[model samples]
Target chain A: MSIVVTYNKLVEFGDCDPARIVWFPNYFKWIDAASRNYFTQRGVPPWHATEREFGILGTPVVDTHAQFTNTASYGDVLSIHTRITQWRKTSFVMHYEVMRDHCSIMTCIETRVFAKHVGNTPDSSHHQIKAIPVPEFIKQLCGFSQ
Target chain B: MSIVVTYNKLVEFGDCDPARIVWFPNYFKWIDAASRNYFTQRGVPPWHATEREFGILGTPVVDTHAQFTNTASYGDVLSIHTRITQWRKTSFVMHYEVMRDHCSIMTCIETRVFAKHVGNTPDSSHHQIKAIPVPEFIKQLCGFSQ
Candidate 1:
């Protein structure tokens, strides 16, 4: 288990749909931000720094499951609690719970991989990214005792 | 088997992140649109029309699972293919595939319910949304034989 990190977000007007409720996709956006906050709160450097130091470009989500428990709308203050529940060689599971005033709003789990750009085809402008092992130094930085 | 309907979208600049790639959550937004398109393509009315006719609000997402296969950036033209894979008493499952030309980008399945508003408390401004039985007329409109 990793340290719990919380990210607070204010639901904006644009985040709502014609139904006047927070669109389900916006929950995933907050979950993604909360995911990064977990690392930042643990003193892990930003992706650019990690890329320069360890060649790890960023963590890319491979699989995600989200459950919507309640509806929300703009002007609502939501708190996202995030943590890494499991760590593997190349992937980790991030769990997020979005709450509004002690009410459960949504919950999500994402499986993400630390990735690096691969293939240097001269003709292709975009390079494919491949998953890489979780860097040990970064793991220690996350305070994961192994 | 359900008839497939495709929804086209142009990836906008705002849809991308600092990495210049389309943020993953945007894919869900497109999936939601594609889900609605599946109904429209089958001659089903919009939610507002349905609400007026049947007191049904809209399909509310309860669960979703997504897998990201490839990365896409701004200015990319993408197609989302969606269809209802199964129908239950009060819920249905939608399957979506996001394709950028010939490449597979991401795929998702969502479980959603036909919902309606319930309860109007004098003190509480918010009302709870509850799932209702899948309307037979709506199912027929979606081209479901049974």
Candidate 2:
């Protein structure tokens, strides 16, 4: 399945720095929000809810890179494109491209790995933890398994 | 004089996915916060205020890259180190390293260019805008000029 989502955002004042250009870090925040929205549109509940229900942890990002091709100013309409580039047994990768007026302005690639939630514990060694396979439903949704 | 500031953060619940580790995008957020705080400690008001007084726009990021060396869980105490790396005519760079328990967990570098903020009218263009020089106060603080 080809999963693609587009979001049009006007650079808000909070999103810009003193220079009135969109803050660099805020771009990543927008991309992350768009990624979550994409999953929500696919009929998958938010990742946190999914984790709590199934005891399936999320894959935290282990690596990330971004390149800015053009400067975006306040009120610029940014179109964000997110797509899954790799889905493995224990890890997955996503690619994002932000464009303005159909021209590419930024790109990013992120890699994440599965992890288990250990409950609150004072001792670092005794925290509850376990590694489990990707859930069948999610694997199917992600097109990794039939 | 070298300036160093440490920020204590409770990894927000929203910062983690099912993986139980800090999300990649949140790393940028944390680093950005720390960097801003560093500036605050140096007596350079927040970027927003600086912009208003000097008519000097902040630099726009041209690139960012990060490597996650270790996994950081929720409620972890993360210490971020930020230092100015390059001070150029119309741009500057910052390097950041995130640590937990004395172990380096992440590193990031960002390059930003100083530019003038033209209005958001349809006729506005980046070309028509100009590059403003770094303010004299900032230059002194950054040790670029005394």
Candidate 3:
């Protein structure tokens, strides 16, 4: 079983739109950060470590959904609670809740894949990424005893 | 009948992540700009215009979902096609399709409400926002007739 982690952030002035409320997209950014923090909390090394260990890049989001319950503004402090809800062969689902004290500001779920740079395209050397089966080592590190 | 609007954009180098792909959140940012462009193209005044005319602040997103179909990198030119697929009494849905040349890169659907500032709270003048019925004039301006 994976453990839940909390990532704290201060809403910056630039995070808000002309409406003075935090732009919705910023929530996704923070959620992505929180997702990384989840791995960090699990004692998983950063993505850079994989180039040497597993020849992997980083996970990429394939789908996401977010629902806003309350509004937030600059100068406000927010906490994002994150956890891996489910893990598939090559992809996993992350659940996140952004809160301000007792207020549940937003909730989100994302599907991300364990990706690797397969090779450069024939037309160009642009690296192509594809989902690979989750490694047993990485899974064990995240407390998934598979 | 609402006409679709296309917003052309250049993916800047700063928008890419360490993975060399455009960070996902930047897509939301462009989608937002495209949303506003839809209104601008429809001859609707900016949200600030509503302060005196209707006391409305702006649209606040209630829910949103997006799916990334392909990876995009810096120096890529993309176009977002946006349209209002449905308009309810108090909220409307915006559908966005992002394209690179002939490839469909991503798609999103957002539900948003017309918002306004209410009175200050007993503790402070902290502005409270609430949703109001979609104004008929605003709908008409978008080519949705009563």
* Prediction 2 global C-alpha lDDT: 0.70
Kindly report which residue pairs in candidate 3 clash with one another.
Answer: none
Query: Model 2, A1-146: lDDT tens per residue?
Result: 65777776787768765555666778877877877666666666665787778765554556788898877777678999887777777667878999999788899988765557657577573234444555566655655543
DockQ of 1: 0.66
Arranged by TM-score with the best first, the candidates are 3, 1, 2
Stronger candidate by lDDT (1 vs 2): 1
Report the poorest 10 consecutive residues by lDDT, candidate 1 chain B.
B119-128
Candidate 1 accuracy as lDDT: 0.86
lDDT of 2 by residue, B106-137 (tens): 99888766556656678664422356765657
What is the TM-score of each predicted model, taking all chains together?
A: 0.94, 0.71, 0.95
Q: Cα lDDT of all candidates, in order?
A: 0.86, 0.70, 0.88
Error of 3 at B43 (Å): 0.7
Largest lDDT belongs to which candidate?
A: 3
Residue-level lDDT of model 1, residues B1-146, one tens digit each, is 78788999999889987665788888888888888888888877899988788767789899999999998877789999888888899899988999999998999999999988776688765646889999887788777894
Chain B vs. true chain B: TM-score per candidate: 0.95, 0.82, 0.94
- How would the docking of model 2 be graded? acceptable
Q: Judged by DockQ relative to the true structure, which candidate is superior, 1 or 2?
A: 1
Give the Cα error of residue A117 in candidate 3, in Å: 1.7
